[model samples]
Target: MATAVVGGRLESELVRDGSDRTKGLSRRTVLGTIAWSSLLSACTSPMTSSGETPAANALATPAAGQTLGSGSVRIALIIPASANGNAGAIATGLRNAADLALREFKGADLQILIKDDRGTPEGARAAAGEAIQEGARLILGPLFAPSVSAAAGVARPAGVPIIAFSTDTSVAERGVYLLSFLPQSDVERIVSFAGMRGRHAIAALLPANGYGTVVEAALQKYASASNSRVITIQRYQLDRVSMQVQAEAILPVLQRKEADTLLLPDAGDAAPFLAQYLASKNIRQGDIQILGSGQWDDPRILAEPALRGAWYPGPDRAAYSAFAARYQAAFGAPPVRTASLGYDAVSLAAGLAARYGQQAFTAQTIANPNGFLGVDGAFRFLPDGINQRGLAVYEVGTGTATQIDPAPRTFSRTM
Candidate 1:
């Protein structure tokens, strides 16, 4: 029955309303119960001691969100939850993940305010404004790149830190951290691996878009660092026709054998066709080692016979499979690959908030060099707010992909 005003609009319209926003007596009872159960775990937590630093093993269990308490930290989750698009399913998975984290960890004092960004920048801006006005200390969402940019415009000035889901490095800066699996990281890993394996000369046939441009730049950067060279770079429009044309354009280079490795980072079923077209040009996998980006992790890519022996960089599937099993048991459905992002973000916020209190969201603490171990692997936030994840290299095999290299369990001092 209480109405809150934000930006001349009723807060109820922007933030969540109705019985979903539970607090007060019910919250207190839950907290009291969890407090008794996790008293030992709380005391033993790395967050409890100033000298003790959290390691990969410390993050293995729910540390901070496990017990309910007062002076709750309000977190705003801005994602597309409406019924109109595919995001509804993803949003359900994300919400389910956050709920599961809370239930398992005892996040009684953590109040999650869900807001629908409607998959638009304007909607994201409005939702962010509502979040800040409603006392949200941290914002977690606005999945798309444009939406993240729009939401950041509002939250940054309000001094609210955002952990967005977009992989766009261009949108990440200062307080707006991106939790998505960046292409640059994938490129760096796979390229470095290739260079170490004696496939130094790299050539990429990338799509003509922002993602492709980033991949190309990443290839150049990582290649130079790894004592490798980017032989040639070709761009395509990312359609069937354009793929064929680009494949043909790069055929001459392939024939000349100037490049030892070929990078095809397209998503969906494009990799098959590109490989098929290149094979038609008498270019076999034996002549040049094929490489893919994280996007090629899809199981559908395994069906492509030409992609056999192709290498790609991606999250440790073993770690993800464990989380997926837990998610399915909780939600009665499989979560999208990105569902961990939401869970990790909320859990991190809850843990840090409980650990450092008001100083949890500051740049100093959030970008700890030790990093945080996530469901996928160990990841750290850089000063620029780009998350660097430790990923593994996968080799496409007969009807499957196997991890050729395991993702590092702990953060290396240099990396």
Candidate 2:
């Protein structure tokens, strides 16, 4: 029925890339592919030496929200932990993850005051107001786009920055950062990779939805940079017959080989159906390379056989694998893909607070062009509040994704 505050952990070292850390590995210093350090296995209670830090569980928040940590620099983590459906589970799991991140980091420069938005915009606004009132220097999450917008309405005027978990690009701007994976990155990575392989022209079968719209816009925007142009586009509803119709419509383009690559931006059965439809039409195995977005990171999509050589872009698989193992060991359960967002947000807060002092949450400090590498490889906040990550290109094999390109250790340009 009310907001709650608790105190929590901090990592002492600068964020490191698992693929690039030269000092080798140590349990005390690990935050990369290994996911966590020995803190989870070694420390039973979170230790904040300042003696003023609140107990880890001082109170319960509205709905199923939880609060963790207590220190001078307080940050708020707003999530829909009590919402209906799988959202509650995902939020709670990730909520615990924020706690785990600070615990593993080994210091206590920050306290996370968590609030539950109950998956509603109004709730998010109220939560943000409470967090700012409680002296929180930063805000993290509300999960969905509407919630992010609502929270931003309150945080923006108060001069508090937000690091949201939504994948929607529309919610990104100025002081609000999206920490989730964006499909546009997939578009850029895959399209550019294909261009290098001598594939310059592209054909696409996009869904008639927002996801499709975002990918399409990215294709157009990155055309000049990637040296790849869209030759044809067929937008279809997400149904078997609709996909077949679109496949048929795009068949002529494929037959002419006008487009060297075909993009199927939808996941689940969409990619499989479209690819199989083309195969049924007697298209040669190597007639065109099928391109996909990060949505294709599913096992069923990878093992669908029809999409054997399809390529997609996503976070570094190796680092995530290692992070998942350590997460399971620390919490006794595996984490969802988005759990990295929560962990990284808290780790970012800690890393900044430790080094930047009171200036930790400033826009200039958070948007470092070099970016910061976490359990999910490297990512940095753009000035526009959207984020870009160092994603790897993966080629789908039999029930596996072969990493064709490693994620960049650092960002290339300061966009």
Candidate 3:
């Protein structure tokens, strides 16, 4: 039998002595003796129950002969499989962050486990079950909204906390905490900043998807809250022809209404085409200031001349330069944007483990008011498990992103 007191809790289990199961004292008695010995030592010793051994007190080492438990704290990194190219790259970056965190917090006995959700709800549920079976106390992903929702359902009952990478606020509930950079916060920050810069009239080109819808709503809300007006709202499919048509239609509205700012939320894959279409319309980049979400971090936007002077809100890239350098050195490539998300997630988990131990590594602790800070930014988890983050504004100038506002400030959300 083996006994240990971990995080101020007594745990005992019977074990065979080598190949001789019947030899020596009874396993239960041995375990009981070990527990009693530990408790007696605690009474006589000045050590804290949280495992903080005083540097000067050398006699308080090893809990006076009680052996440490062999159980490992499992952490799952759930992401879409290798099929989706962009998602795969993001997952690789997340894995790299996990590897880095393991090296940083080596004393926690943390064991990272990877689970591919395959970008499906069913796959997420199965992956979550596998993680639980392998004894995972914390989960770090399921990049997509549907998968995050499904994985949260499976982990909640088991008291495991999930640090999801999905930007959708709806998926953040129960035991799930969003660790991704959300577009709504970015929209609010950019709109408020632009408003402060005297850009009153705003127009938007959004995709016909849930994410785009959220961005559109956020733009409208923020515009009204900031005392700015949204002159035109145009929706477009991902197709080039559809985007061209929408861009042309919006160009006439912008010209007529004289809107100075054009907000575009869908900036991936469609950014270059949208930029080209806007350029063809003779709508110079300087004429109308382009406001974008964090999605504008893609390098493709930098290549477009029409995207110059575009402003967006995102994580502080400068703060993560060292992390990116180390990640690239180890993984042979720089981490994707979501890699910072993973690093933050692991840091959050390690902080919780250090502060509250294994028992405190639950859903409620993640939703604490004084939440953990990471490479991305300062975030506090709400009661609903959604992380509220402050976003910094970045401006694209001469094919480079310039930090206009290095610090994130509070904005009115009344509208």
Candidate 4:
């Protein structure tokens, strides 16, 4: 027998159990880690090494009022449950992760009102409005970029803080925090690491989309700061023809050895095919170091022979491994890339409510200079809603990735 806390009521139903806890997380990092050791006792996100799975019937996507937990404080969990394809699948994983978090943190003192965003701005707006009207003090999701923006419109003026899951930095703002793995942070980590290895003069083949735009800006900003120059950049739309055409455009520069590092800031086959294409043109891997954004965290992509020795950034694998094992046991499927955001957000909220009570979601608490160490790694929200994390660097090898640079354990007071 299992009980679910859906809003003000705790229904005796079925759910999942627990798993081992992880000390670190994935998502972001800067050069400096926070040194706020003294703050760990009071406001830091709490962790436990051991957890057991809860046994109960789980819903793939709750239509509404997935009301979880019977705690006094109210919080909202918004996701795109009605969206087509991947968005809906990710929504289920996020909800399960949030439920798993509440189970692990037995002391959590909040009721979660889960709302479906229908994967649209209007849907998210309605969900956010309903949740706030239900007395939600904080909002946890609405995964897509548009949905995050829509929810923020409602949450911001209501004094409700949101820890959204979108990676698009454009939607991030004063009260809307993004907890997804951002492309900009990945660019900074990979480029700076490459600079340390003396592989500067950067060149890139990026997508002609919003994600690509953010990556190019990050590359330019970091390249300028580090005295490195991006000798060339080419953008392509989605489709093999466009990708092939763009990669060919950059072949001349690669053949001339004008760039010491080639940044393939895309995920999936784009990075692999481009690397293979460049190799076929006789641009030896040793001559031009291949760099990738966190999007390269995919195992199959990392293990590609064409991408072997390429470097990228990611959250700690061990923590994700631990978390994934538990999630797999409970949900019976591997988590979506950004699923950890749901777990971390719920865990952090629980800790704040338990410790600081009503003052938990305040800017100061959420933006603790030291940042909170969670399932993905050490991450802290900024007033601008751009989350900073301590990200680890990895190199692709034979069917696996090796950590070349460990993530920072703490944060400095700088940000």
Per-residue lDDT over 20-69 for candidate 1, one digit per residue giving the tens place of the 0 to 100 score:
11001000001111112122122211121233333322212111122222
Error of 1 at 261 (Å): 0.6
TM per prediction: 0.80, 0.85, 0.73, 0.84
Q: For every model in order, what is the number of clashing pairs?
A: 3, 8, 0, 33
TM-score of 4: 0.84
RMSD of each: 10.9, 8.7, 15.8, 8.2
lDDT of each: 0.69, 0.71, 0.63, 0.73
Better of 2 and 4 by lDDT: 4
| Top-scoring candidate (lDDT) | 4
Q: Give residue 185's lDDT in candidate 1 (0 to 100).
A: 82
Lowest summed lDDT across 10 adjacent residues in model 2 is found at 5-14
Of 2 and 4, which scores higher on TM-score? Answer: 2
Best by TM-score: 2
TM-score of 1: 0.80
In model 1, what lDDT does residue 33 have?
12
Candidate ordering by lDDT (highest first): 4, 2, 1, 3
Runs in model 3 with CA error above 4 Å?
1-73, 80-89, 116-120, 272-282, 362-364, 409-415
RMSD over all Cα atoms, model 1: 10.9
Predicted structure 3, TM vs. truth: 0.73
Q: Give lDDT: candidate 1, residue 292.
A: 93
Query: What lDDT would candidate 3 get against the real structure?
Result: 0.63
Query: Residue 41's C-alpha lDDT in candidate 3?
Result: 14
